[model samples]
Target chain A: MTALKAIDKTTINIEKIRADFPILSRKVNGKPLIYFDNGATAQKPQQVIDRIDHYYSYENANIHRGVHTLSRDITIGYENARAAIQKHLNAANPCEIIFTKGTTDAINLVASSFSKRFISKGDEIIVSVMEHHSNILPWQQVCEEKEAVLKVIPINDAGELVLDEYNKLLNEKTKIIAIAHVSNTLGTINPIKEIISAAHARNIPVLVDGAQAVPHLKVDVQELDCDFYCFSGHKVFGPTGIGVLYGKEKWLNQIPPYQVGGGTIKTVSFEKTEYADIPLKFEAGTPDIAGTLGLATAIDYINEIGLDAITTYEHELLVYATEKLQKLQGVKILGTAKEKAGVLSFIVEGIHPFDIGTILDQMGIAVRTGHHCTQPLVAYYRVPGTVRVSFAFYNTFEEINVFIKGLEKAIIMLK
Target chain B: MTIEETEQEIIDEFELFDDWMQKYEHLIELGKSLPIIDTKYKTDDKLIKGCQAQVWLHSELKDGKVIYTADSDAIITKGMVALMVRVLSNHTPDEIINAKLDFIDKIGLKQHLSPTRSNGLVSMIKQMKMDALAYKVKRE
Candidate 1:
C-alpha cells in the first residue's frame, strides 16, 4: 500500500508488503510458513481476497445481456478490468485482451484458434526445451492433429537457450514460435524481445507464455511486439481460474473463435449467425467475472509497489540464496543463466529431491521438487529432478537462512 | 509373525521417535534396508512414475508365499515400499489380499496416501494387491 517511489528500490518496506499476505503469518507444520513456492503460485494478498468478496457481495450479476442496474454497473467494472489489463501490457486495444481460465487455457486458446488460420499439414511449432508443459502440450496436440512437427529449441549447460539452433529451425514451414517469457523451473528470463523481432522478420507469429514472467517483470506487449502473450492471474497474487491472452489486432482478426457459447454472438438464427469481434469472439459462456475483478485488484496492488522495485528486490534475494546454496557442499545449482529470476533449483549429491522436499515441508519451508511439469527439461539436465525454491517480493533474508539450515538438516539425515 | 503383528511393530517403532525429524531419519534407514530388486525388473515398464518420485515393485511366489521386492529413487518412497514389504511379503495371497495396511496412517505417513501428492505410493499399494490377486487366481 506504500507508494514510496522516491525511496531506494531494494529498501522498499518488506514488512508492509509481507503484512498484505495473510497466509504468510500462519504456521504449516508447527513452524511459521517460509513460502518459497511462488513459481507454483503466489499467495493472495488481503486486497485481492477482499476485492473478490466485495464483488460477490455487492455486484453479483450476469454480464452483457441484462438491462438491470446490477448488470450495467458490473459490466462497466468488467470492461474497466479489461482496460486495466490492456494498459498493464500496453496492448494496442482493450479488445486485444481475451480473458481465459489461466496461462494453460490462454495457450490452448491461441494454439487451437490460431492454428485454424495459420497452421497446415507438416508446419512446425517451435518451442524451447525449458518451457513448462503448459507451453508445450497444446502445440504438441496441434502438431499431432495436423501431422505437423513440434520442433524444440535447445539450451546450453547454463540453462540459457541456444539462439543459433533456434535460428536454424526457423524456415517457411515454421507456423508458430511459442516460448516462455521466463522458465518456470530454471528461472531463466529468456531473450524474448530479440526472439520476437527475429520471428517478426520471418512473418512468423509468436505466443509468449508469460505466466512466470508477469509476476516478477513488467511485460509490455507493444514494446516486445510479440503477436500474442498469455499469463495467469493466480501466479501474480490474484485468484485462480482467471487469465488474459493479449493478441495483436491483425492476428486476432485472422484467428477464429476458440470456444463458442451464448455471450459471443452478434445475432443468432438457424440460417446464419454473425459473431462479435476479437475478445468476445474468443471468450464464450459466463466468464470468471469475480476472478477478473480480483485480478484487476491484484494488478492495482502490484502497480502501487511497482514492478521495478520487485525485480530489483527479487534479484537480490535470488543472488543471496544462490550464493548460500553454492557454499553448501555437494549442492549443485541448476540453471545458472546470467539473467535469471527468483527461482533457484538445486540437487544434492546422492540425495533425492523428494527426500529433501519432504524434510523441508516438516520444517514449514515449502519448495517444489521433481520435474515441475517440465519433464523434458529435467530429462535434458539428466538429473532425477530438482529441489526448487522460488522466491516472491515478500520472502526475506531470514527465511533464506532458515531454509539453508533446514536443508543442511535434511542433508545430514538423508546422508 | 502375522501381518497385524508386523503392523503393530512398525507403529511401535515409529512411536519411539520424539519428533518428525527422527521419524524421517528412521524412514531413511528403512529405505536403505529394502531388499534389492532384481536388475531385470528395473525397466521403465515396471516403473510406477510418481510426479515427485518413482517406485519399482516386483513380486514372485516362493513356496506358495508372495515375496515382494522393491526399489525407488526417492528414499521416502523406498522406505514406504519397505514397510509395505514387511507387512505383505512372505504371506499367502489370501493373507496379502485381505491385509488393509491402515498402519500407514497410524505412523503419520498419510500424506503419501493421497493421489494428489504425486508420489505414486497409492498405485504401488494397489499394484501389490493386484499381484496378490493374480497369484490367488492362479492358485485356484
Candidate 2:
C-alpha cells in the first residue's frame, strides 16, 4: 500500500544485505532462522566481525599511552571511532563523544555525575514510564541519594507520553528531563525534538536514551539539541560492550568525572588529582579497543547502506507486520502510537505470551517474550507480558510471512 | 509403578509423535486433563516463582505418600506441570524426593522448551521436591 511505496527499492538490495550477516544462514529446529529479536540485540554483519577479528589479530594493544606501533595504531582506531560516532550523531565536537560499556553504563555515568552537580534535596528529575530499567534505575538511585523527587511522565492508553502531563511535571525545581527517543518495547518514536525544545525553553537539560532509536532512525543530536544522547553499539549491528554517549561540551564540562583512573586523569598524586579533558575524563581504565573499532566499522556499514534506506525499509516491515497481525483473530497489538519504529508487541486473547513465544521458537522464530525489561509498562497494560517481534533492515517480507504462519499455529495450539 | 517406569512410559508415549507440533498437541491435551488445584490453596504463597506462566502448587501427605495438585496460566506449562505431577503424585515422600524425572530429556521436551520455560520447569521440580521434603519432615 502507501507505506510499501515509501520503501526505496533502488538503495537496498535485501538479499545481498542479508548475506553480510553470517548468523542469518543458521537453522533452528529444522527450520531457517527468522530472527525478530533485533530489539534485544541485532545480528552482526561480517564487516564488524572481521573488524574485531582484525583488531585482535594485528592491532591488539592498549591505547593512548604506549609508544609502540600496535598501541599507536589501536589508539587511532579507537579515537577514530569516537569521531565516527560524533559524525553519526552530528555532535559539535568529537570530545563530546564518551565511550562507555553500553547504554546502561552511559546513563549511569550521566546520572551519577550530573546528579552530583545538579540535583540537590527537594529537586525533581523527570523520566517517562517507557524507559528501560537502565534509564529509570540510575535516576532513581540519584533521586534516593540526593533526596530528590523522581517525577514520571505518564503514558496514555495508546502508549504515548501525555505531553500535557509532562508539561505540568516540568517546573523550576525540575533539574533534568530524561526520556527514551524510541521505546524498546512499544516502538513509540518519541517527539524528542519537541520534548528537548520544551525542556530548553525552561532552561532544563534533557537526556535522550537513543538505544532503540539509533538502530532504526536517523538521529542528529545537534539537530535535536538534546543535552545528552546515548546508545549501545550491539543494537546497531556492532560488537557488544561498546556504546557512545554524546553530551554537549558545556554540560560535560560542568559535570564531574564518572570514574578516576590512569586514562581519565591529567595529574594524580597522594593529595591532588586533576582529570583529563571531557571524554578521557569520563573514560576510566582501559576501554574496549576492539569493540570500538567494530562499532566504527558498523557505523561505516550503516552509512554505506544509508539511514534513509534503513528507515524506509524497516518502516515498510513494521507496517506489513502490523497489518498482518491486526488481521489475525484474537490478536491485540500494543503501542499504537502514530509514530513508531522497529518493534511490534502483541498478545493473543486467552493465550499466554510465553506459550506463543515457545511455539514460535519451535518453528525457528526468535521473538522476545516477557516484559521486555519494561515491567511498569507491562503492568500498565494489565497483561503478563507481550510477544515482541523487533525487526532490522535485513529482515524480509518472506520472514514476516513465516512469522505470521508460526504465530497462527501457536495461537491455534494455545487456544 | 516405579518412578523410572513412569518416566519410561511418558518417553514411550512421546515417541508416538513424529513432529514437535503433534507432541505439543499431545502436551496440550495432557495440560487440559491436569487436575485443578483447590481454590483455597491458590494463594500467592502457593504460586511458583521464576515461571513465565503463573503456576500454583499444593500438596498434602496421606499415609506417608505426597499428593500434589497444580495449575498453570499457560497450557504448555500446565502440561509440563501435569507431567511432573503424573510421575511424582501419590508417591512416598522419600520416593518423590529421590526422583530424577529424566523423562523430560528422554521425551526430548528439554530441548524444545525455551531457556526461560526450562528454568520454570526446574522451579516446578524444585517446588515439588520441597513439598515432598516438607511432608517427610512433618511425618517424622
lDDT of 2 by residue, A1-415 (tens): 2344566487999889999999999999889999999999999999999999988987799999999998888888888999999999999999999999899999999999999899999999999999998999999999999999999999998899999999999899999999999999999999999899999999999999999999999999889999999999999999999998999999999999988887988888999998899889998999988889999999999999999999888998999999999999999999999889999999999998878988898999999988888988999999988999999999999999999988988888878
Which residue segments of model 1 deviate by more than 4 Å? A1-11
User: What are the RMSDs of all candidates, in order?
Assistant: 2.6, 1.6
Tell me how much of the true interface, by contacts, candidate 2 captures.
0.68
Cα error, residue A86 of model 2, in Å, equals: 0.5
Chain A TM-score for each candidate, in the given order? 0.97, 0.98
Clashing pairs in 1: none
DockQ of each: 0.83, 0.72
Top lDDT hit: 1
